[model samples]
Target: MRADRLVSLVLLLRRRGRLSAATLARELEVSTRTVLRDIEALSAAGVPVYAERGRHGGFALLPGFHTELTGLNHDEALALLIAGSRRGAQAFGLGSALASAMLKVVDALPESHRDIAAGAAERLLIDPEIDLLSRRVADEEVPGTIVAEVRRAVFAGHKLRIHYTAAGRPPQWRTVDPIGLVTVRDRGYLLATRSGADRTYRLSRILAAEELDEPAERPDRIDLDRAWQERSTRFRAGGDQVTVLVRLNPARQEELLDTALAVRAEEAGSDGRLRLSVTFQDSRHAEWALWQLGTDAEALTPQWLRTSLRDRAAAIAARYEPP
Candidate 1:
């Protein structure tokens, strides 16, 4: 770990020129004293690192000195390229940085592997602004300034205040202790707590944000994955869940499961259709998913849901019949 930190310190100075110990500590999530020790270690290892003293003093690498530790194998380089292709980074306001880093990674590769890797990456495409199906998935509008403020608060362990608007509600301001930020499928969320109660806020819906002077009330160490999972499980179980029994074409089974919350049971009908018992978010959710399947699926139980689908289909049929 210490060796990795020392190498990173050298690379940082090489790339960004002079930087203060305080800045290095913030970037490395360590203390200024630790950064000073690492600088000493790098110099002791003949890295040509030097410190400038006085009011505007910091650490820097000698001119023309560069670290040779950016040697990534072909597969590793390709993986980085694939990660760079994702749109998630753009949602979190790191799009330009990601692009710049990818360029540096490509430039640092050896000549033999460089052309092949770059060409191969070109063949792969992801998260296009517009897809072939003509589905207009425009990027979610997350204010860069607000996102930056929230990020600083999250990383610096400062409390945050945000003006958020929930769906079908008026915008309101609230103070929260931000635990972390999560971005999934190009959407960003602030996982936080307000007055000791867990709250999740959509970043696109945050009209304004301010980082408070007070420290965030959160644990010093956090297991983000575990916390996210726990929150997700509780959310899924808390909604008005409904169980649905349906008969669907065998070929369309995958489609039904894709929209379902859970598949409680599955069995094959004598006629080769699939009998599926699934859970959905609610009655409206079940109705909508089944309607999309058209004649390929039929609801079997819960007369209300069956009636809802029938009414919707009849409404559509009425529109075209003799009108």
Candidate 2:
């Protein structure tokens, strides 16, 4: 990351002013030769880095030469750093560009506030794969080339042909009028229309993509949020959705909510636990979610679920019984 080192070198000179090559090497943790090379690179890139020849002389930027971060305050700069580092940014194939931009963002910030903003961003964590239950989150694999092609089609307003494989379905070629792209929970989706019907294709399932030269026959103006919302509404409406009544330890409530479609009703009981109605995609989904809570949750109305958990627990207990 010579580029990062170069940015650091400039920041150091901008902050401290006229530090010797040895000092820049110490701060950048690189050899003085590397520091000199970076200074040369910066100067070549029109960064106005000049070296003075004397015992006290060192590298420094021209006076009053700085890149303001568009008046971004400390918090705003911190937010940009955090957002740029999210793995979800990779969903749209912007990882490299985002990294470069974020570096530039830090580079452009006022020198006095720059270090503090960069340090603060390091303290915040977002979207780690492992949860409190130690279950690793799903990270779907998607080819960068396919995403790049799909992104081109979506932004260029061109037709896209994709060899898409829907779950439990064979890969089939679909030509879609690209509308927009959306990334939810680290999964990328292309929102398009086929013959005027809405179609959403997951990026991971796209085995191949070809951007057609023909322009997309999509609405000139679209409310992407509204379109995605309608599709989500339809998807939830069409599923074998089931609502379950359950009681769970308040501490485990988040775990249940993570697996649920939505919370229909909730009540905090006298026992300091939650009694609630929650929806899942189906009965199996509801049963599986409750079972994960072990004794921390109880299925109140779903008798079959209770029986299922009871039978599962009994079988486990029986296996551990003494001979």
Candidate 3:
């Protein structure tokens, strides 16, 4: 660890020319005394490191001193830098590792491209904790220990035993052959099979996990995309799916489409509104989504859904009518 820190110290000086002891300490997350000692170590090792005196005094590498670390071009470096900004790695319990790797990546880039690539990456943002309305998007917390165990099983072709908490149910322990992990919309899921039946478990819902010594019963090589698609198709087809026809304001079409499971049909209304026949996971899902749109959308068919929405509106209106 100290060796890596020493190398990073050299690279930091090489890139920035001169940095105060406090700045070096902050960048390397070490004590100022540690930076001073490392500077001496570098100097003793004939690394052309020296310190200046006075208020602006700091450590500096000799002029024209640089290590050769060239490989990535501009675009490639930018892409990698942008990837380092993602929070997806945090979902897999690798946040610290990702940060360290990103630091190493920047250090290894050619000096000519390092600052520009890193600076450009700062301009790009990834996940946001809050939306435009100030409503927060809460990230699901997956235990690092659990994630480590599961990840190890997945990569090592071993089975895993987990205590999973399904919706409105008690936690039950099950042994599974994990295929891979997926993160979507900030939620992480472990794609696995139990008793040869595909099962998806939310990582947050895993109360306990243990990797088994036995090998997993899965293909030697998996195409995760293909596997995920097949499982998704089967899941969508097996759910309590319902179709609802709705008339919505053209501007609100996206809101409806975003929540709908599928758009069965679409047409423009004579009144300039949009007509959409869409599928929902269930009646409750349909009711909740349309209710959010208020006057912007109307349930055209499926009289039961229209009735439910009307009753819901009536209830809300009754509350504020008089008393």
Candidate 4:
């Protein structure tokens, strides 16, 4: 409402010292005319607001003026409580810190919102260990010391040396310009540049870490999200990408989707099965996903895949033949 907006306008001016009318409107998500009116309203309400008439000025609040606003509203309080309860905080080794902050938040909330927010937050769960299929989610384990060392380097903008082991490769020590850390799907990754090339390492695969004294050589500003997206796009487009058509049991649709690189098209068959065209990184990837479904999915094309499945099934049957 206007009261909240006025309070926000005062707070913005207080924190920023001085801001242009256009800037205030943009920050408050209102129009310049509305900002002017809010400024007049604040002045009329005995607030020490003043305007600096100049090509480079708009509005300012007199120094030493402050308002004692109460804590957040109910929705804001509940949203923060719910977000703080997520596992993402634990991935960054901030579980204890997050717990402490949550306590402060609960205590600072208006008495009417405190109990309700906490109770509502308690009923929410995010990223549970066990999925709907009864399969346990595997949480990748990384040593706290290793994570702390890498985290220190990332924030300090220093070079770091790490003993890293890629899949099917022996551990090797490499010095890298540390960029930042990212956590997705309950796993952590270190995004950095190796030998001037973008490299992402799974935190679980980092055996040891050492922060170097030399400052890292990197751009002053980085768009980490865009960088990650570009790398992910390159990765998905790499390798012998393959697309396969399959008819899968409707009940197992999620399983197929979870394993495929991407879904191209999907439709329901007259037989009640789900017909889907899915892409995988390669033939091996396609076979792995289809095989996981066993008899629940049938690969409809790439005669070679059909023959491979048939031969594999025959061998399995022979192995279990009555003796």
Task: Show pairs that collide, candidate 2.
Answer: none
Q: What shift in Å separates residue 196 of candidate 2 from its native position after superposition?
A: 2.1
* Candidate 4 local lDDT, 98-181, one digit each (tens): 566567677877898898998898998867889999999887878878987997898889999999999889999999998887
TM-score, cand. 1: 0.72
Higher-scoring candidate on TM-score, 1 or 4: 4
Q: Residues 1-323, candidate 2, lDDT per residue (tens digit)?
A: 88778877878777888899999899989898888888888888999989898888988899998865565554344335546446666777766656665777778778987999988989987777799999998877887788888877887899999999998899999899999877787888889899999888889899999999999998889998899999988877777888889988999988898888888899999999899998888888888899899889999977877888889899999999999
lDDT of 1 by residue, 1-323 (tens): 89778878887887888999999999899999999888888878898989899888999989988654265543344335446546766666666656665777778778977999988989977777777898878779887799889978998999999999998899999999999977766788899999999888889999999999999999998888888888877876877898989999999988988888789999999998999999898888999899999999999988999888888879988998984
TM-scores of all predicted structures = 0.72, 0.66, 0.72, 0.75
lDDT of each: 0.84, 0.84, 0.86, 0.85
TM-score of 2: 0.66
Count of backbone collisions in candidate 2? 0
lDDT-better candidate, 2 vs 3: 3
Segments of candidate 1 deviating more than 4 angstroms = 1-85, 109-116
Winner by lDDT between candidate 4 and candidate 3: 3
Stretches of model 3 off by over 4 angstroms after superposition: 1-85, 110-112
Model 3: lowest-lDDT 10 consecutive positions? 73-82
Q: Give the alpha carbon lDDT tens digit for every residue of 1-323 in model 3.
A: 88889999999998888889999999999999998898888888889998898899888988888774365443333335436446667777776665665676788777988989988988976667787999998889998999989988998899999999998899999999999988777788899999998899999999999999999999888888888888777866777898998999999888888888888899998999988999999999999999999899999889999999999999999999986
